[model samples]
Target: MLKVIYILLCILGTFLPYSQFLPFVLEHGFDIRLFFEQLFANRISGFFGMDVIISSLVLWVFVFWEGTRLKMQNLWVYIASNLLVGVSLGLPLFLLMRQFQLEQQTDTAIS
Candidate 1:
Protein backbone atom coordinates (compact mmCIF):
# COMPACT_ATOMS: atom_id res chain seq x y z
CA MET A 1 0.00 0.00 0.00
CA LEU A 2 2.75 2.43 0.84
CA LYS A 3 4.69 1.42 -2.20
CA VAL A 4 1.64 2.06 -4.31
CA ILE A 5 1.35 5.52 -2.86
CA TYR A 6 4.98 6.25 -3.60
CA ILE A 7 4.62 5.06 -7.16
CA LEU A 8 1.56 7.21 -7.62
CA LEU A 9 3.43 10.20 -6.30
CA CYS A 10 6.28 9.46 -8.68
CA ILE A 11 3.90 9.38 -11.60
CA LEU A 12 2.35 12.62 -10.48
CA GLY A 13 5.75 14.22 -10.01
CA THR A 14 6.92 13.20 -13.46
CA PHE A 15 3.78 13.97 -15.41
CA LEU A 16 2.82 17.24 -13.80
CA PRO A 17 6.20 18.86 -14.40
CA TYR A 18 6.65 17.34 -17.80
CA SER A 19 3.27 18.66 -18.82
CA GLN A 20 4.46 22.18 -18.14
CA PHE A 21 7.97 21.78 -19.51
CA LEU A 22 7.05 19.94 -22.69
CA PRO A 23 4.91 22.73 -24.01
CA PHE A 24 7.53 25.30 -23.17
CA VAL A 25 10.29 23.29 -24.78
CA LEU A 26 8.24 22.71 -27.88
CA GLU A 27 7.48 26.37 -28.20
CA HIS A 28 11.01 27.56 -27.48
CA GLY A 29 13.00 24.91 -29.39
CA PHE A 30 14.49 23.08 -26.39
CA ASP A 31 17.29 25.45 -25.55
CA ILE A 32 19.09 24.83 -22.25
CA ARG A 33 20.03 28.51 -22.19
CA LEU A 34 16.44 29.66 -22.12
CA PHE A 35 15.62 27.08 -19.47
CA PHE A 36 18.23 28.48 -17.12
CA GLU A 37 17.23 31.96 -18.08
CA GLN A 38 13.74 31.27 -16.86
CA LEU A 39 14.92 29.30 -13.87
CA PHE A 40 16.77 32.30 -12.49
CA ALA A 41 14.41 34.82 -14.01
CA ASN A 42 13.66 36.57 -10.75
CA ARG A 43 14.74 36.73 -7.14
CA ILE A 44 12.05 34.31 -6.10
CA SER A 45 12.84 31.83 -8.86
CA GLY A 46 16.57 32.13 -8.20
CA PHE A 47 15.99 31.39 -4.54
CA PHE A 48 13.77 28.46 -5.33
CA GLY A 49 16.24 27.01 -7.80
CA MET A 50 19.16 27.43 -5.43
CA ASP A 51 17.18 25.85 -2.63
CA VAL A 52 16.36 22.82 -4.72
CA ILE A 53 19.98 22.47 -5.79
CA ILE A 54 21.39 22.72 -2.27
CA SER A 55 18.78 20.39 -0.88
CA SER A 56 19.47 17.97 -3.70
CA LEU A 57 23.16 18.02 -2.85
CA VAL A 58 22.34 17.13 0.74
CA LEU A 59 19.96 14.47 -0.47
CA TRP A 60 22.66 12.92 -2.64
CA VAL A 61 24.98 12.59 0.33
CA PHE A 62 22.32 10.91 2.41
CA VAL A 63 21.38 8.65 -0.46
CA PHE A 64 24.98 7.66 -0.88
CA TRP A 65 25.52 6.91 2.80
CA GLU A 66 22.27 5.09 3.34
CA GLY A 67 22.46 3.21 0.06
CA THR A 68 25.91 1.92 0.94
CA ARG A 69 25.07 1.15 4.55
CA LEU A 70 21.92 -0.71 3.54
CA LYS A 71 23.55 -2.39 0.54
CA MET A 72 20.76 -1.07 -1.63
CA GLN A 73 21.12 -2.49 -5.11
CA ASN A 74 18.97 0.11 -6.80
CA LEU A 75 20.75 3.18 -5.55
CA TRP A 76 21.39 4.30 -9.11
CA VAL A 77 17.73 4.01 -9.85
CA TYR A 78 16.95 6.33 -6.97
CA ILE A 79 19.47 8.83 -8.25
CA ALA A 80 18.11 8.63 -11.76
CA SER A 81 14.60 9.11 -10.48
CA ASN A 82 15.73 12.21 -8.62
CA LEU A 83 17.41 13.57 -11.71
CA LEU A 84 14.64 12.72 -14.13
CA VAL A 85 11.76 13.47 -11.85
CA GLY A 86 12.24 15.51 -8.66
CA VAL A 87 13.06 15.18 -4.98
CA SER A 88 9.39 15.11 -4.18
CA LEU A 89 9.20 11.72 -5.87
CA GLY A 90 12.71 10.35 -5.48
CA LEU A 91 12.95 10.82 -1.69
CA PRO A 92 9.76 8.91 -0.97
CA LEU A 93 10.54 6.33 -3.60
CA PHE A 94 13.85 5.63 -1.90
CA LEU A 95 12.05 5.43 1.41
CA LEU A 96 9.60 2.93 -0.04
CA MET A 97 12.47 0.80 -1.31
CA ARG A 98 14.15 1.08 2.07
CA GLN A 99 10.99 -0.11 3.75
CA PHE A 100 10.92 -3.15 1.52
CA GLN A 101 14.56 -3.83 2.28
CA LEU A 102 13.91 -3.64 5.99
CA GLU A 103 10.96 -5.99 5.67
CA GLN A 104 13.11 -8.51 3.88
CA GLN A 105 15.79 -8.34 6.55
CA THR A 106 13.17 -8.85 9.23
CA ASP A 107 11.69 -11.82 7.42
CA THR A 108 15.08 -13.44 7.05
CA ALA A 109 15.99 -12.84 10.67
CA ILE A 110 12.68 -14.29 11.81
CA SER A 111 13.15 -17.34 9.66
Candidate 2:
Protein backbone atom coordinates (compact mmCIF):
# COMPACT_ATOMS: atom_id res chain seq x y z
CA MET A 1 0.00 0.00 0.00
CA LEU A 2 2.66 2.50 0.97
CA LYS A 3 4.89 1.03 -1.71
CA VAL A 4 2.16 1.54 -4.27
CA ILE A 5 1.77 5.16 -3.21
CA TYR A 6 5.50 5.65 -3.53
CA ILE A 7 5.48 4.12 -6.98
CA LEU A 8 2.67 6.43 -8.04
CA LEU A 9 4.52 9.40 -6.59
CA CYS A 10 7.61 8.40 -8.54
CA ILE A 11 5.56 8.26 -11.70
CA LEU A 12 4.11 11.68 -10.95
CA GLY A 13 7.53 13.10 -10.24
CA THR A 14 8.81 11.81 -13.58
CA PHE A 15 5.93 13.55 -15.32
CA LEU A 16 6.59 16.90 -13.64
CA PRO A 17 9.15 18.05 -16.17
CA TYR A 18 6.74 17.32 -18.98
CA SER A 19 3.99 19.19 -17.18
CA GLN A 20 6.28 22.17 -16.83
CA PHE A 21 7.14 22.02 -20.48
CA LEU A 22 3.53 21.90 -21.61
CA PRO A 23 2.94 25.65 -21.58
CA PHE A 24 6.05 26.33 -23.60
CA VAL A 25 5.06 23.68 -26.08
CA LEU A 26 1.58 25.09 -26.27
CA GLU A 27 2.99 28.56 -26.95
CA HIS A 28 5.16 27.15 -29.71
CA GLY A 29 2.05 25.51 -31.09
CA PHE A 30 0.61 29.07 -31.37
CA ASP A 31 -1.81 29.12 -28.44
CA ILE A 32 0.09 31.95 -26.72
CA ARG A 33 -2.78 33.42 -24.71
CA LEU A 34 -3.98 30.07 -23.45
CA PHE A 35 -0.38 29.10 -22.75
CA PHE A 36 0.29 32.14 -20.61
CA GLU A 37 -2.96 31.63 -18.77
CA GLN A 38 -2.16 28.04 -18.02
CA LEU A 39 1.41 28.89 -17.14
CA PHE A 40 0.58 31.64 -14.65
CA ALA A 41 -2.48 29.87 -13.28
CA ASN A 42 -0.10 27.28 -11.88
CA ARG A 43 2.50 29.66 -10.42
CA ILE A 44 4.61 26.74 -9.29
CA SER A 45 5.51 26.02 -12.88
CA GLY A 46 7.42 29.26 -12.87
CA PHE A 47 9.88 27.66 -10.51
CA PHE A 48 10.13 24.23 -12.04
CA GLY A 49 13.82 23.76 -11.32
CA MET A 50 13.37 24.67 -7.70
CA ASP A 51 10.39 22.38 -7.49
CA VAL A 52 12.47 19.52 -8.87
CA ILE A 53 15.21 20.14 -6.35
CA ILE A 54 12.75 20.25 -3.46
CA SER A 55 11.03 17.13 -4.74
CA SER A 56 14.37 15.34 -4.95
CA LEU A 57 15.19 16.27 -1.39
CA VAL A 58 11.78 15.08 -0.23
CA LEU A 59 12.32 11.82 -2.08
CA TRP A 60 15.70 11.37 -0.42
CA VAL A 61 14.07 11.87 2.98
CA PHE A 62 11.49 9.23 2.07
CA VAL A 63 14.30 6.86 1.13
CA PHE A 64 16.06 7.49 4.40
CA TRP A 65 12.83 6.93 6.31
CA GLU A 66 12.18 3.65 4.53
CA GLY A 67 15.73 2.44 5.00
CA THR A 68 15.53 3.14 8.71
CA ARG A 69 12.10 1.57 8.98
CA LEU A 70 13.18 -1.67 7.30
CA LYS A 71 16.49 -1.77 9.19
CA MET A 72 18.14 -3.32 6.19
CA GLN A 73 21.63 -4.71 6.71
CA ASN A 74 23.19 -2.04 4.51
CA LEU A 75 20.93 0.80 5.56
CA TRP A 76 23.74 3.32 5.55
CA VAL A 77 24.82 2.11 2.16
CA TYR A 78 21.33 2.65 0.83
CA ILE A 79 21.12 6.07 2.44
CA ALA A 80 24.49 7.17 1.07
CA SER A 81 23.69 5.78 -2.35
CA ASN A 82 20.36 7.58 -2.42
CA LEU A 83 21.92 10.85 -1.28
CA LEU A 84 24.59 10.66 -3.95
CA VAL A 85 22.17 9.74 -6.69
CA GLY A 86 19.63 12.28 -5.56
CA VAL A 87 22.22 15.06 -5.72
CA SER A 88 23.92 13.93 -8.90
CA LEU A 89 20.86 12.97 -10.89
CA GLY A 90 18.81 15.93 -9.64
CA LEU A 91 15.85 13.57 -9.85
CA PRO A 92 13.50 12.17 -7.27
CA LEU A 93 14.85 9.19 -5.26
CA PHE A 94 11.46 7.65 -4.68
CA LEU A 95 11.98 5.00 -7.34
CA LEU A 96 14.94 3.50 -5.51
CA MET A 97 13.01 3.19 -2.26
CA ARG A 98 9.96 1.98 -4.10
CA GLN A 99 12.02 -0.75 -5.67
CA PHE A 100 13.45 -1.65 -2.31
CA GLN A 101 10.01 -1.85 -0.77
CA LEU A 102 8.74 -4.02 -3.61
CA GLU A 103 11.67 -6.38 -3.25
CA GLN A 104 11.31 -6.55 0.52
CA GLN A 105 7.62 -7.27 0.21
CA THR A 106 8.25 -9.97 -2.36
CA ASP A 107 10.93 -11.60 -0.24
CA THR A 108 8.68 -11.63 2.79
CA ALA A 109 5.77 -13.00 0.82
CA ILE A 110 7.98 -15.71 -0.64
CA SER A 111 9.17 -16.76 2.78
Candidate 3:
Protein backbone atom coordinates (compact mmCIF):
# COMPACT_ATOMS: atom_id res chain seq x y z
CA MET A 1 0.00 0.00 0.00
CA LEU A 2 2.79 2.37 0.86
CA LYS A 3 4.67 1.49 -2.32
CA VAL A 4 1.52 1.97 -4.33
CA ILE A 5 1.09 5.42 -2.88
CA TYR A 6 4.68 6.29 -3.56
CA ILE A 7 4.33 5.18 -7.17
CA LEU A 8 1.26 7.31 -7.57
CA LEU A 9 3.10 10.22 -6.05
CA CYS A 10 6.00 9.70 -8.45
CA ILE A 11 3.63 9.86 -11.39
CA LEU A 12 2.04 12.99 -9.98
CA GLY A 13 5.39 14.53 -9.12
CA THR A 14 6.61 14.16 -12.68
CA PHE A 15 3.39 15.20 -14.32
CA LEU A 16 2.30 18.14 -12.21
CA PRO A 17 5.52 20.15 -12.33
CA TYR A 18 6.27 19.44 -15.95
CA SER A 19 2.72 20.38 -16.84
CA GLN A 20 3.53 23.83 -15.52
CA PHE A 21 7.12 23.98 -16.71
CA LEU A 22 6.87 22.68 -20.29
CA PRO A 23 4.69 25.52 -21.40
CA PHE A 24 7.19 27.95 -19.98
CA VAL A 25 9.95 26.26 -21.94
CA LEU A 26 7.87 26.39 -25.08
CA GLU A 27 7.15 30.07 -24.63
CA HIS A 28 10.62 31.15 -23.53
CA GLY A 29 12.90 28.56 -25.10
CA PHE A 30 14.81 27.91 -21.89
CA ASP A 31 15.31 31.51 -20.97
CA ILE A 32 17.24 31.17 -17.72
CA ARG A 33 17.28 34.92 -17.13
CA LEU A 34 13.57 35.30 -17.56
CA PHE A 35 13.01 32.23 -15.49
CA PHE A 36 14.94 33.69 -12.60
CA GLU A 37 13.31 37.06 -13.12
CA GLN A 38 9.87 35.57 -12.78
CA LEU A 39 10.89 33.16 -10.04
CA PHE A 40 12.07 35.87 -7.68
CA ALA A 41 9.75 38.51 -9.05
CA ASN A 42 7.91 38.85 -5.75
CA ARG A 43 8.40 38.07 -2.09
CA ILE A 44 6.22 34.99 -2.12
CA SER A 45 7.93 33.61 -5.19
CA GLY A 46 11.32 34.40 -3.74
CA PHE A 47 10.40 32.64 -0.53
CA PHE A 48 9.34 29.53 -2.40
CA GLY A 49 12.48 29.63 -4.55
CA MET A 50 14.76 29.94 -1.57
CA ASP A 51 12.89 27.18 0.21
CA VAL A 52 13.27 24.89 -2.75
CA ILE A 53 16.99 25.64 -2.97
CA ILE A 54 17.48 24.77 0.67
CA SER A 55 15.32 21.68 0.35
CA SER A 56 17.27 20.48 -2.64
CA LEU A 57 20.53 20.83 -0.74
CA VAL A 58 19.08 18.92 2.17
CA LEU A 59 17.75 16.24 -0.15
CA TRP A 60 21.16 15.82 -1.73
CA VAL A 61 22.75 15.33 1.64
CA PHE A 62 20.06 12.93 2.79
CA VAL A 63 20.31 10.98 -0.44
CA PHE A 64 24.03 10.56 0.06
CA TRP A 65 23.99 9.68 3.73
CA GLU A 66 20.97 7.41 3.99
CA GLY A 67 21.39 5.91 0.56
CA THR A 68 25.02 5.07 1.26
CA ARG A 69 24.13 3.59 4.62
CA LEU A 70 21.55 1.35 3.01
CA LYS A 71 23.97 0.33 0.25
CA MET A 72 21.53 1.56 -2.32
CA GLN A 73 22.89 1.60 -5.81
CA ASN A 74 22.62 4.28 -8.46
CA LEU A 75 22.26 7.13 -6.00
CA TRP A 76 22.89 9.50 -8.87
CA VAL A 77 19.47 8.63 -10.20
CA TYR A 78 17.87 10.50 -7.31
CA ILE A 79 20.06 13.55 -7.85
CA ALA A 80 19.34 13.46 -11.56
CA SER A 81 15.64 13.21 -10.93
CA ASN A 82 15.96 16.12 -8.52
CA LEU A 83 17.79 18.21 -11.11
CA LEU A 84 15.42 17.29 -13.90
CA VAL A 85 12.29 17.78 -11.86
CA GLY A 86 12.53 18.66 -8.15
CA VAL A 87 11.90 17.18 -4.71
CA SER A 88 8.46 16.25 -5.93
CA LEU A 89 10.02 13.50 -7.99
CA GLY A 90 13.14 12.85 -5.99
CA LEU A 91 11.69 12.38 -2.50
CA PRO A 92 8.96 9.93 -3.40
CA LEU A 93 11.24 8.09 -5.78
CA PHE A 94 13.85 7.65 -3.09
CA LEU A 95 11.26 6.55 -0.60
CA LEU A 96 9.93 4.00 -3.04
CA MET A 97 13.39 2.58 -3.60
CA ARG A 98 14.13 2.63 0.07
CA GLN A 99 10.96 0.74 0.78
CA PHE A 100 11.87 -1.86 -1.78
CA GLN A 101 15.31 -2.25 -0.29
CA LEU A 102 13.93 -2.62 3.18
CA GLU A 103 11.53 -5.26 1.98
CA GLN A 104 14.36 -7.11 0.37
CA GLN A 105 16.35 -7.01 3.54
CA THR A 106 13.42 -8.34 5.48
CA ASP A 107 12.98 -11.21 3.08
CA THR A 108 16.65 -12.01 3.25
CA ALA A 109 16.60 -12.03 6.99
CA ILE A 110 13.55 -14.27 7.12
CA SER A 111 15.04 -16.70 4.67
Top-TM-score structure, candidate number: 3
Error (Å) of candidate 2 at residue 38 is 23
- lDDT for 57 in candidate 1 is 79
Local error of candidate 2 at 70, Å? Answer: 1.8
Q: How far is candidate 2 from the true structure (C-alpha RMSD, Å)?
A: 8.7
The estimated TM-scores of all candidates read 0.88, 0.36, 0.98
lDDT of each: 0.83, 0.56, 0.96
Which residue ranges in model 2 land beyond 4 Å of their true spot? Answer: 1-46, 73-102
lDDT of 3 by residue, 20-79 (tens): 999999999999999999999999999999998899999999999999998999999999
Ranking by lDDT: 3, 1, 2
Of the two candidates 1 and 3, the one with more favorable lDDT, higher being better, is 3
lDDT of 2 by residue, 1-111 (tens): 655665565566446545755666776775768656765666586576456467657756765676667664454543464344333332234355546766888899999
lDDT of 1 by residue, 1-111 (tens): 888887887778778878987898889987989989999999999999899788777778888898888888868887887787677767877888888888898899999
